[model samples]
Target: MLRAATREAVALTGHLLRYPSGIQPEQITDPGAAPPPATEGEGTGAPPVLLLHGFSDNRSTFVALRRSLLDNGWPHVHCVNHSLLTWDVHEAAELLGEHVDRVRRTTGHDRVDLVGHSLGGLIGRCFVQRLGGDAFVRTLVTLGTPHAGTYAAAALPPHPLARQMVPGSDLLGELAGPTGGGCATRFVNIWSEHDLFVLPAHHARLEHPDLAVTNVRVRGVGHLMLPVDATIAAWIRDELGAQPTLFGAAAERAGERAGPGRPDAAGAA
Candidate 1:
């Protein structure tokens, strides 16, 4: 375990060194404006997939996974890098709503797919479940997101967003509420067994009586790796590419992937 953690840590260091290159200039532009060149790509009739990163992370994390998507017929892939200084999930949800609208308009598609990692997953969920984002999201795939708050947040330095992730915060209280039964958006929650930052780790699973969720268990992968591992990325592309599930009964491929390595940078969540 020690050797594996060391290897993952080194891999993350390489990502950090190259992170500066992945910075999107458009993040400084108005959120209401159309996305920049980074969001541009050819369409293959597949709904555009928007990649959302975790807390304090940028679009760089999804480079490998995004390439896998674009290479495998999921041509129109976009990413949203929200301000790291932001405070509340509710506010971030609103920002996500605006961006989702822009992505739809920019791609000329009414509905799109979402793949959010860690905190990105919660932000996407808050938008879909709280802010009527279901109308715009066709398939929502979260990678290692904490649907219920995680004890991992307590280990981080206190911040507003981190506080909201403290297991039973008021914001989580809102997420704990009953979701509408009529929500048509398909939810695929892909969580890793080796994600140490999610506390008990199972907190990443989304199990609501009202929502039909496809929970995929990934083995031997870490929180940060969920967005980058090649094998898992292929699985994600296949999941989104699969035909839509009808009558609110999406065929659940409830299983695990034997992905490589273990959890990366604890601060990534």
Candidate 2:
């Protein structure tokens, strides 16, 4: 009973999945002789944005955003691989930190923006909070992130790693607890009212006053529809393209020194 459009879309997705669609290292670098740094503190500035995909998904999830950012002149888009089928939130955080450092070093920028989906958002938060990532990230945007637990976890197998995402589980609670470190980063959480994986839409919204969390309402979008829709991309671009509305006296002064409205001023670290 599949519609012609649906069948065509499925075939196109299959082709994209099978294609080597990632942006490689050489592709990110150049031959002007002033190569991007290999570590933090080694460049003019770090890449402007970083994209992290959700669980069971690959770097291709952010393909559209990557193209958009590049076309918008915000290059240095890197999508992370979460060691899928063997997920580890903590390790994923560490890996994310390393990638952030790499971007900082290579691009010579001190801070970068982050866009994450689902579990990738949790992992990004961990990086900002516990993995010394606050110094390198400016803005954090999450799409369909389960700030609480997802009801769909109930149907998942009782595997050790899978338990991390189980609804009402201790792991999810720990992630939600106050870590007391990455308090300065601005955050935006996007969610869909019709997400089948996460019941109680609020489960996807973070309730932190210090965090600039925006609970976006995308209509009729599913849990696994990160790249299947256009609204989320527009939301992310809008959030990242704006300046933070709140910053204390100390941070505000430092931000002013960096130049207001510029990407560097928005740098959280």
Candidate 3:
């Protein structure tokens, strides 16, 4: 376990060093170099997917996964860069709301699917749960997020957002209230068994009574690699492609009984 953690840490460091600022400005603005748009006959019923990176990370972190989705017939995939230094998760969620609205307006799609990593997952959930984002989000997929907060966060330097991520924080309390109730969006929480940053990795799972939630267990990947992991990317792509339906209260109960680390019956692409 120690060796695996060390190896993952080194790889994650390399990923961060390679794309320090996340997505490059040129990649966003280069019209001629953009990923191919969906053809008229393809992706006719699928909603556009919006990718959100973890705290202190940029849109570039999703480059590989985004490319994989596009190649597999996902019509539109967009990434957002949030303020790296923002200290409030709610504030970030508000910003994300604006971005979601813009994507809906620009694409003429009534709803979009969200894929958020780490802190980005919390931000997206805040929008869906508190900022009226459920109306516009068909599905919410989170990777390596501290849904229940984590002790690991307590070790970080004091910051409002970091404080909020500590177990039993007020912000987490508010966000945890009856999530998924009366919301039309489906929630998929994906976490890695080997994620060190999330402390007890199961803290990343969502257990809400009123929401349709699926807790997906992934092995081998670490916190930073969740977004880049090929198996995870394929699972997310499949989830996004499926039609959105409320999982209902009973189904959620059944899932809980099944416990965690259940193999992804959907398999990989």
Clash count of each predicted structure: 0, 9, 1
RMSD of each: 6.2, 9.0, 5.2
Compute the lDDT of residue 165 as modeled in candidate 3: 85
Decoy 1 TM-score against native: 0.83
Model 3 agreement with the true structure over 1-269: per-residue lDDT tens digits = 56446657876886767686565532232232323333222355467788988766788788888898888876668888776567799998998887777666655667888999988899998999988899989899998999999899888877787888888998889887875459888898887777899978888888777778888666666787778766677667767877332334565465532212334333311
C-alpha lDDT of residue 269 in model 1: 23
Worst 10 residues of 3 by lDDT: 25-34
Give per-residue CA lDDT, model 2, range 26-67, as digits (tens): 123433343544332212233468787776656766767777
TM-score of 3: 0.82
lDDT of 1 by residue, 1-269 (tens): 45435545865886898688677633422344453333322337777888888888888888888888888777667778877678888888898888777766665667888999999988988888888999888889999998887998998887898888888889887877888657778888888777888988888888876666877766666777678776667667766877443212433444322233323321222
Q: What's the best-to-worst order under TM-score?
A: 1, 3, 2
Q: Candidate 2 — which residues are off by over 4 angstroms? A: 1-47, 243-269
Model 3 segments beyond 4 Å from truth?
A: 2-7, 21-45, 179-181, 243-253, 256-269
Q: How many pairs of residues in model 3 come into backbone collision? A: 1
* Backbone clash pairs in model 1 (N, Cα, C under 3 Å; residues 3+ apart or in different chains), count: 0
